[model samples]
Target chain A: MKNALFVLHNSADTRSSEFATLAAIATSIGNAGYSSDLLILDTTGSSSVNVKHGSAFRNVTAVAPDKAVGDGADYLVHIVGKAASAAVSLVVGFGTISNRNWAPQVAASFSAEFVTACELIEVADNALRVTGPVMGAMVQKTLSLGDRNAVVLYSGENLAAPEGTDIVVEVSREPAEQGAVRFVASEALPDSGGIPLRGASKVISGGLGIGSGEKWRLIEEFAAKVNAAVGASRAAVEMGWVPSSRQVGFSGQKVSPDVYVAVGISGAVHHLAGIGGAKKIVAINKDPEASIFKIADVGIVGDYEQIVAAAMRKL
Target chain B: MDIVVLIKKVPDPNLPEQFVSISDAQDEVVLHASSQYSINLYDLNAVEAAIGLKESAGATVTVVTADDASADQYLRRALAMGADNAIRVELDDKSRRDSFKTAQALVSALKQKSIPSLVIAGRQSSDEDAGYVPYLVAHGLGIPALAPIVSIKSASERTINVGKLADASIDEYELTLPAMLLVSNEINKPRTPGLKGVMAAKKATIEVVASEPGGVAGVPSKYSPKKGQRAIEATKFIEGSDEDKAAALLAALDK
Candidate 1:
């Protein structure tokens, strides 16, 4: 049977882990007729492994280096190198910062084929099919890997965490090579005060039409009224009305909120890509022809300030 | 010292959805006549970072890309924006689309001269969005790759400090010389060329290199949307006065 290895690198300080998505991916691999296993790279050097394992993975293992390996590319490469084996037919990872820094290097280590932004993977009659949206999520591209080893990177916002057994085999190893990069420190995102955007139950976003940085407070006011996280279109971010962390678009944070509200947003394809996972979208725009209305469950064409003002009063 | 920045020309991401569609027979994206092409926005940030580094470290900046002759205009734009030199690796459309082949071709071209002191590219091109080429090149040349950095905090001949954006924090790192760095948009605001720079770019000569036969790693056997993917249908606009619209929107949330 073909074997697939799903790997997640965890840090104690990190709030949201891609464990759920990795588990979900492993299930997809299993459905495609491949035996899947889970490997967690614990940067915290914790001896205990706490992951809700599902039937998707046949085995789960947690690895930590004996020495403090700073979150650098060299150490990540070293860790993945230690865990990856020749017998694994597929190596899977999430497209996060730490993984992106080293996953390709591991692919190079084994001379395996590498693909990124992988949205779906399935096998039919021995052909490995991998599909992902490219061109700002405007089009989808599918690739077939025929009996060749592959390393694939997937975005995790689309899938839920797997549920089942709780078992992990913990192991430790030594870093044999000296590192080339040194970790200095991590600082909080500037001016990113308020509810976090990702995983928010509700989101309210503003765009260039918000007028200016001062008026951006309206978005916050409305969001507070509805208890929604504040989000911004790329134009708003570029205009410096909000921090990049608050931006929602192809290059910004991807949010999968239960409800996403767009006020004064023109609905660029890139902005729409970030909110694709939202369960319900409500668009408030002055222009009736705004693209946001197309995908929105409910759209109101008028001055956003008036509508938001009315909604705030009612709330 | 030499700093190399990789750039790509892609269909303008701002193009309306009506202008873009999938051609099933061709197994690729097709842009209508009204669509436009520009430098991948993220790569523009990379170019800006490279120029800033060149100005600070007194290094020569070289912009490199693997594409056909049509990409020359974008290369000229880079030079106008402040790159010292530009090189284009002549690869066909098929080869250019394949990340492995593109990396191989770039590796071949980069080797013709001495290895650069630093290699930089956008985290990913807006088109392919693979983000695999730079890392592949780094691996091929046996250098470490660090990416999505927001700022180059400090720099010296042998080492450099960079700031990377994490979930809600900024992670800083010091990388040794001869590393690969993929820049994010937060790095710097890209500059527009003035008349002087534009005229100079028009007069500047671009170095063109023929692509070497880089063996294929693995090509996709098929390219298409998922079989059962659903297209998002247009929704009906909620009708009524401002007060009624607000009520309807809030009511819809209740359901």
Candidate 2:
């Protein structure tokens, strides 16, 4: 059985939800056919209190006992507070500066044993799946391997199987697959709370040639008009016009919104990965060639900015 | 002191006309590297930061990339921009892999040289967006780690003062010698390599290799959106005068 090392921002007593999320995530890992070990760091005061074995954290694969350096499994994860923590040699930083992602903490604590690897899959700008048949992709994905512990991404609404999968389907933002995944097993946590999406909507959606950040004002105007929220294509966000929070793509937010509108947005599969299953999709790109038009029951092929203005006028 | 800065070659996260099926079909990738925004932004900045540090502290800077032959071009730019050397960790594997093992291989390489006092890296790479390497190296090396450092003040041979751009406030810390820092856009402004540097970067030598055994991370699944069905009715843009337009917009959205 593979092991997951979870790192936490504070001890369980402090960040209860984080612990809960870890348990739930651990449960998901178990469901996916993997085991987990948790690590929690309590920087409540100057004195660093490290809990180890089963005493401080029950079932933790390997918790840091008195600022112990590295001794963990294959996967290290940091949870709660974007700060990076290490129980093992593996290091990871996620979630918000305050509410970190659940997996990195575990990965960090188990850094030593777990050899982490990274892969780039083929997916649309808005979605995170590599192109290929689902079955073949599933087989390829399953057949393919990474170092002992690795973080992988895919698009669609499935985790490939009912059990025995050691991957996670995180619906949050995915930045460059570079040094952004921070880890620190030795000392002070990798204080990394560069949350490009906090306080913003849980999921944002945008579309089409949001070519320039200034032009994004048009999309933002529409988003403001609807108050529904904003998400963008790999196109607009790349143009550097919109906030990464508002980006929607295979590499961005996977949103399940109360309301979603595909304004001036094309429904590319990559883009679809980020906005698939929106309650309501309203496409308004000018290009009838825009794929979003196909997915949009409410397709409008005209100048998006003008149409948005018109729509705004009507609203 | 020698500083090793690691960068990644990733696809631009932004593709204008993208489709999920695009990733599904190999023949369908819309764009290539240098086209992706974040990879260039972060990678370039990493190179520039290395140069800046070398200039400020009288250190030699080397850049390493776990990328392909094509990225040799990107790394060469680093050398042109004043990086002493560029090492490319080329892998034969084309199948999707994870970041952990790649970093492991990189750490091994860095160890051959003097262990860097401070390793600088981008906060995250654009292609994978997994965001977890610099921390792993720091952990593996058993050193202190600082990320998102926006400001820095070298205090002495033993300690360095830095500022962390926290969510709400500025968090300051005095880092002791030999620490690893994961930089975000928050750090010092990263400069662009000049045409001269870019031309020079093209000729640098990089190393590539066969990746070791990485296991199946798992087949990722798609997410199901919970949004309701959109109206099948014809979409009519609410319109009127400027005031009417604003009113209509507000009325339609009811925000």
Candidate 3:
């Protein structure tokens, strides 16, 4: 029988939705005839192991931070939290096993490593699929991992269960202090205007099609309306229209925001590399043949200035 | 103080897609003869960050890479950009080195030479997009690693103050010497190599060292040509005046 292991932090809130999500995933795996193991990490220094078997999980094991799990599991799932540092440490510690499929948190610092190590299939709002290599490009292909080991990183929110499956597993633990306080600062530093593009959930970027540096204000104006970080293409940066720090491409920052809006930007492979992790892409360009349209969830073939301005107003 | 910067050479990703082709086995990508190759952009920023330290604190910056003879040009470019020295850890096939293997090779090279007070590398390489080498190197050397650093606020003999960008806020860290830092492009703008510096670089000799054996193999390639419908077939092309188009786009965005 196939086995799935889930690693999650013990939350103090008994009604935590994350626990529900875990139960749902466990139930789905059980319904599919796979055994589920839950490895819970307690921040309160408790070494007690609580075994809970319900409609979903077969066993729940509480483990210490230093304890290690045995290999040969068919799947590994890591539930990530808001603290990226904490999430990354867990991934590095337990997500080891080269060439295995792992679906880490979409925006985690180590997400790129997972992408490089695994065969990424499709990225959705609540889940992502990773499987063995595909032979040729096929349309509407559904990936099924018969027996290969797969790793999925999820936050335990917005999960969808299989049909006719009811999850009713309850597990609770104390919430430990959040954030990985690994490094201590000497003193508080002043903030600069450096764009926080790394963690931005929404990004609005522009390209040379905006014409001049002055006209780039449209991007900023639109970004301000949506509270998004501003980004630029290499062409704009090379033209001295924007700082290189704002450049988003293979040569610049790699961003995986939830929503990426590209205005007047013709998508190049370099530019697409930076936005590969973006959940939803919206492109606005005058050229219908612009490469950005190929990957965009929604494409608008029109004047970016007018469309962005109107969209900003509507928002 | 001694600072070491790690850099990599990659196919200029800005090249048109037509200039690049994937192998039939879907295991490799071949660049056309006309395709140009250059330093990874983030690695360039790392070089700049090291140079900035040298300018402010009189640190000696040495740039290193695990590449072939073709990497000498980029090493010279780093020299022209203000690195004090360059070392290329010559490998038979650089593509075979994964993050673990690359870190092992780099650590081996460092053990053979002087250990610097600080090591700097780009957060990740654009080609593989794996931000693992820095942390792996740090772990291998038993040192602290701070990554995705946006800025280095200040530096002293013992510690360096820096800012790390997290999900929503900037976290500050004071790292002791003998640490590793993976910098993002927001750290600083890389200076261009001037003509005089370029001339000097052309004349300078790059030290070459052989990489150690038994490096870990790279992840197996699983890329296949995408065969799905790239664009939505029923995409509605709104045709109207700028105002009408703007209204249409707003509605679409709302949807």
- lDDT digits (tens) for residues B1-255 of candidate 1: 689998888888678767877676846677898789888888889989999988888889999989988889989998999999999989998777777888899999999988888999998887777778888888777788887788899898998999976655678888888999998787889999888999999999999999875675556534453233214566658778889988976775552
- Candidate 2 chain A has its poorest 10 consecutive residues by lDDT at A131-140
Interface root-mean-square deviation, each candidate: 3.5, 10.0, 9.1
Better of 1 and 3 by TM-score: 1
| Candidate 2, CAPRI quality class derived from DockQ | incorrect
Candidate 1 lDDT over A129-230, as tens digits, reads 777667766676777776777888875356666666655556565553656776777777754465767567788899988998888988887777677789
The CAPRI quality class of candidate 3 comes to acceptable
Best by DockQ: 1
Better by DockQ, candidate 3 or 2: 3
Worst 10 residues of 3 chain A by lDDT: A132-141
Give per-residue CA lDDT, model 3, range B107-159, as digits (tens): 88887877788999987675655566676666566566665677888898888
Worst ten in a row by lDDT for model 3 chain B: B222-231
Error of 2 at A191 (Å): 22
DockQ score of each predicted structure, in the order shown: 0.55, 0.14, 0.23
Deviation of model 1 at A310, angstroms: 5.5
* Location of the lowest summed lDDT over 10 successive residues in candidate 1 chain B: B221-230
Give per-model TM-scores.
Answer: 0.88, 0.59, 0.69
